[model samples]
Target chain A: MTITVAIDCMGGDHGPAVTVPAALAFVRDTPDASVVLVGQEDVLRKYVGAADLPRVTLRHASQIIGMDESPSLALRNKKDSSMRVAIDLVRHGEADACVSAGNTGALMAISRFVLKMLPGIDRPAICASLPTQSGHTHVLDLGANVDCSPEHLLQFGIMGASLVGAIEHNDRPTVGILNIGEEEIKGNDVVKRAADLLRDSGLNFIGNVEGDGLYKGEAEVVVCDGFVGNVALKTSEGLAQMLAFFLRQEFGRNMLTRLIAVLALPVLKRFKNRLDHRRYNGACLLGLKGIVVKSHGSADAFSYGFAIARAADAVRTGVLARIAERVAQGQTQPEPA
Target chain B: MTITVAIDCMGGDHGPAVTVPAALAFVRDTPDASVVLVGQEDVLRKYVGAADLPRVTLRHASQIIGMDESPSLALRNKKDSSMRVAIDLVRHGEADACVSAGNTGALMAISRFVLKMLPGIDRPAICASLPTQSGHTHVLDLGANVDCSPEHLLQFGIMGASLVGAIEHNDRPTVGILNIGEEEIKGNDVVKRAADLLRDSGLNFIGNVEGDGLYKGEAEVVVCDGFVGNVALKTSEGLAQMLAFFLRQEFGRNMLTRLIAVLALPVLKRFKNRLDHRRYNGACLLGLKGIVVKSHGSADAFSYGFAIARAADAVRTGVLARIAERVAQGQTQPEPA
Candidate 1:
């Protein structure tokens, strides 16, 4: 099986400085893997080595989605943008999958517009691989569909379950709906309806998982709408940073505390690495016609490399095909919605 | 001024085992602060001390709200529940304010029912202090009202802004709506509607704030629907646990990494303290006719003490009176259906 990943060269906070080298590193690491660098040839060449440059194909894209541009406008007008072109590579079968650290909204929009939704799939949900206390869990619809129906949430459960299966190697993943509490009749009307649909969907549905359960990794798949999902993802990121900042302040409080910190050095280092976003850099937008993985915007070379590797992993694991099969067979329908 | 805190002794994960000691500790620490422990006399006496318990008062109540009970059902049926009695103390001016580390849904439901909403207030919003990259930011509506209107969010902004004034001492706090992006035009229909309303309402609106910005303390007042706020709060809690787990695993990795960990000890402890929920354990249910505060169920005596302190802060700062004035002055508009 061949895996070719389309890289958006002109994406992210640092652009080609991070994306180009990351792509090269990924290809070098995986000798058999192929990658297409989509951006202006001149800009991309600066980051790639001349000796081994030809190994990575450079696809010219005239348009580039600005960080500030409206997603709908960019998707509609910037048809040949780097992000769109890279997504097109997967749609056209030129690449097995696509990866980008671009505008998340634009990436999601293009993935849906170009690659289209999987058969019988009402919407494509974005699943973020988050590190948790127990291990790791997959959080879905991290800003894909703003409004979701009970059936849509059920579909997310199926897709999230399948994705978690591929990543966590759990044949029947435990699925949970993100809610304030762990009750059958909690949350708003939508969440309540979704819980009912999920419980009867024939999946290994765990009752509702509260916020604390997320880190416990009690459920492999945690499902919610884009708005909530996005909020969850951001809140996690914010808290992580907050903790890091606070830790520094506490350590610096006095000489005695500083010495204690030094004695506990090894433990602290290990802890920081576990919470590092780089370890789980790439997130796959599931239920699309093809694989489209998003890396964090502020990700460095190592993180971007992980995103490329994640795209390759998705292709290797045949996530899209499994989703297609699931959708095609109408196996994703909720028992009752 | 003497501070009297009404504590729901029957509420929490371990009930009186945790709440009783926590209340005693608060009174011991703050000489002027007194506590009214509300619960059945027998259960209250099991945890309450005899000698130094002079500052503490017991208010007997036979009913209790089970954690699994629906918010509406518990609020309606458990009229004499300890949570209700604790809140009633604040309503009747028997206590300056109230604190409960129990079922969140039940607390919100009962608090709103007994305490009532301020004049011109459509709903009472739950505002929690979240650890951010910057010191602190208050994210509101963390499960007060699930189905929120634009006006509800606007009210949240007003209440949250006043909270910043009271706590952070910010003259006119910057308010931001929780969205996937920082742009004014981004987000779903609800966010867009809320943004439009906030912009016109004549507050210190700062457009939309993404999840990542929460820790950055970009906005002193962060507003969202109860559902989104609750998810965000839970996600932060989950992420913190996940990071802590990862750090422990990393610390146990090997000898070489262990050496680096030693040098980074001070920084790590500071980080943990900065993100610790204990530092900001209590959140006010804004727009209530009287002050009501909710504490984390898993709160230790220290955190419960902080909850009592927080309630005192709200009362001393006259937050409810300020909110009543803001609502009456027509600073925020009505929600459009």
Candidate 2:
């Protein structure tokens, strides 16, 4: 099946300078994939090569959304924005999925308004893959639903499990709730009630997984309220940046240490490549009627390609269909008391 | 005045093996500080040296609290446990403060029951200093009150600011509410309301701080509900561990890299020392009428010594009095609408 992904070429820090080239490279590399570059026609035209015309299509979008623009304001004002146009393609079935390196709040808000939500799903969650010791773990509600109910968390668990099952080809993925402790008695009222519902949800519930366990790859899918998940995700980023700074400072302290840094450069580079955040750039807006993936706002061409690839993978693997089916099945099951 | 800190010598993973020696070393090094070791007499006697006797006192407690025991059960059943005895020492004026490396929940419950809350403060918060780019930032409610009201968060800000003021000698520390975004509209209802309350508060209230801002040292004190704080802390720990593991794995990949690892050992060691968790081992249990500090359960002697020193610092700086004064002042001021 040929998967077509819509790209918001005018979004993110670099605009078409990063997105257009990323889209061209994506279609060139993936034989079974095509891309629609959505932005102002005159601006994006300069970035696309004439040789790549067969698989690349240019769709005009007159307006642009600022990285710091309010989500609600952008939704109401920028009707023809690259971000909105990209999602509109997915809604109109012109594209199988959409990828944008834009403001996360704006992307989420626009996608939800355009694509709507899947049946039986009360809210859309921002699900993203994070690097772990074993491999990677998919955590949901990164910043989409700040306040989530027990039933919403249950839906997240179901949607997350379905996403993992579809993408990893694993029939049964281990699902766990992120909590302060592994014990059932731990956490607040919402977390405790969510745990009870998940226990009887018929998924491969692995009980509570602590914050550290997320990196340990203790579960395939970790569910949390957006408030907690967003903090966890951003905290990890801040810590990684600080550690890198410390390493540089230590290595550059004096003449002897500087020599040692040169000798160890290859190993350090390899270590960095193994845990590169660029490899995990795409974040899925789960539970939407159509697929929309968000890339980091500061992502460059190389990292943006990963986000486009992720959207294509979702389309090829039928992740949206899988999630819809799971939610439908969950609605039939009696609610957990 | 000489500060006296009661030590729970029979607590933590290593029990007397780690805690007793740490207490002895602490008193030996600190000229104006003494420790009253609370534990089984037989277990702690072997660890204390003759030279440490002048500044150390052994106060025998017959029972012990297991590390994984339920908090309520431990609080009610283990009245004679070393953990309880240490808090009891502070409550009865036998010691100016107390330090424990026991189960956190048990310590909080026992401390609250014994010392009671300071006037106008609803609950205790776990405040700990984390390594940041500039120095360190003190984050509070790490795991004490998982679900916090806006008023509870406002109280936490007051208490955290007071603690920083006492310890760091900074009377007007900048405080920020932890949120997913820096915008006023970001986060759930509690955090938004808390930000409003903080703005109207008498303290130096900076606006919303993102997760990454915590390590950036954007604010001196970052206040959040216990659930978010706990997850952020543990998530940082997990990421740090993973990075360390990846570094080791890469360095030991082959004979050439192994040789390079030897050359890079000094630089690597210095980097490790700069970010050592031992230097930040103690978490202050704030809002209690008396000062109580908690050490990491898996801390070694060197790390546990920091917790003892922290308790001494708290007592000498009169942190409890500072918090009481701040809360009382807050009560007199009109509540934020």
Candidate 3:
């Protein structure tokens, strides 16, 4: 089946400069995919030209939201903004999914208001992919609901497992709740309660997994409250950036070291290519009625392109449909006595 | 004045094999330091000869706490265990501080039971130093308390600031609360309330910092609840290890790449040293009545040596005294109207 994705052309730091090129590259790679670019008509036309661009359509919108805009303020005001317009396209069935690299708070708020929540889901979670020694692991609630209840965490587990199962073609995915320690009695009240609920939730629930478990491939899906997940994700990025900075400084310390650096350039390039974050840039805003993918605000063409691909992949794999089916089945399950 | 440190010789994964050599190296490096090695007599004597060891004295203890034992079981049952006995030496004023590489829960549980909390401090925090781009940033509550109230976080800032001020020779060290975002209205209720307290508590409070703030050197001491801090710390470690693994895998891929790896060996060594967590291995159990430094359970001889040096440094710098003074002074301040 042909897949269509709505692109927020005026979102993020570089806006159309980044989004336009990424959209072109994405559609070029997918034979049966098209993109609906949302932004100001005059401004977007400057980039796309008057000629018929292959598999691309431009939709006009009046307002633009700043990267640092207040989410509530942007919500009440900017109904015609590119971000809102893109999500609206999905709601209207003009596109199967929408991808935006904008203010995260603004994007989530607008998407929730426009698309609403799926059945049996109180709040949507931010689901992202991280690299592991064995392969890849999916983590949810990266920053959407900062103060998640135990119930919210359990719902996140279901949504995350569904997303992975749909996209990765794994029928039964292992779910692990993230905690401070691996023991049964290690976590705070929320995690402990969530663990109890998960144990009886009828899913393939493993016990508690610590922070290292995410990278060690202990489970396919790791669930945590948004506050903890955001900190973990950011810390990993910070540490990786620091290591790269130090490596550059060490290589440039002296003339001999610089010569060694020249000889080691190929190896360093290969190493960097293998760990390049752009390859894992896209993250789905799960539990929403329609598919919404949030790209890194500072993502370049490469990462933004991957985000476009991610939106199509989610649509093609029917991730949102699978989550809806599971939630429906969960509602029919007997309530705990 | 000479500082005598109590060393838990039977603690950690390697037990006496790691701690014994580390204690000797520590004494050799410090001019006015002595150690009381506490463990089983036979096991301790195997590592340390029957002859008199310079600046090292063996104190026989009959029990050893397993790494996976229940904290309460170890605390209530094993009073004369190596970890507990070492802390007792400090409690009785026979040693200035204690160092252990044992199970963290057991260490914190035992230490709190032996050395009560300082006045006005409801809980003790685990404070660890992390490698940052500028140099190093200190982060607290790494795994001590999983659940924390707003008041506890405010107290953590006070204690963390005091520790950094005393040890780093800065009278007023900057303190940053870790949160999901930098905005004033961006975090959970607990963090928002804690921010309010920090604003008027008279500390050098900068605004909230995201995870990247720890590595960017935004603050000298980063404060958070133990759960969030532990996740951040462990995620950093896991990411670093994964990057290292990828680098190794890339370098050994082919013969030409392996030759480039041989040339880049010196640069690689410096990179490892700069980002080495061992250099910043020791973490303080702050707000305690006396100093207690906790080393990594898997720490090698060099890291264990650093832990010993950390205990002595905390004693010499009067870290406990400073925290006590701040806590007492804080009690005199009137509650918010």
Q: After superposition, how far is residue B118 of candidate 1 from its true place, in Å?
A: 1.5
Residue-wise lDDT of candidate 2 within B1-337, one digit each (tens)? Answer: 9999999998899988999888888888999988899998877778875444787899989999998899999998999999999999999999999999999999999999999999899999999999999999999989999989999999999999999999999988999999998778788999999888888887788989888999999999999999999999999889999999999999999999999999898889989998899989999999999989999999999999999899899888889889998888873344335
Q: Relative to the unseen true structure, what is the C-alpha lDDT of residue A28 in candidate 1, on a scale of 0 to 100?
A: 84
Better of 1 and 2 by TM-score: 2
Candidate ordering by DockQ (highest first): 2, 3, 1
Which tens-of-lDDT digit does each residue in A1-337 have in candidate 3?
Answer: 9999999999988999999989988888899999999999898888888887888999998999999999999999999999999999999999999999999999989999999999889998999999898799999989998888889988998898889889999877899999888888888999999988888887678989888888888889999999999999988888878888998999999999999888878888877876688989889999999999999999999999989999999999999999999888892334335
Report the Cα lDDT for residue A151, model 2.
97
DockQ list for all candidates: 0.55, 0.86, 0.77
- Model 2, residue A119: C-alpha shift (Å): 0.9
Off by over 4 Å in 1: A49-54, A167-169, A249-269, A332-337, B49-53, B72-77, B167-169, B249-271, B332-337
Model 1 local distance difference test score: 0.82
lDDT of 3: 0.90
lDDT of 2 at B50: 40
On a 0 to 100 scale, what is the lDDT of residue A120 in model 3? 89
TM-score of chain A of 1: 0.94
Model 1 reaches what TM-score against the true structure? 0.91
CA shift of A292, model 2, Å: 0.6
* For model 1 chain B, the run of ten residues with the poorest summed lDDT: B328-337
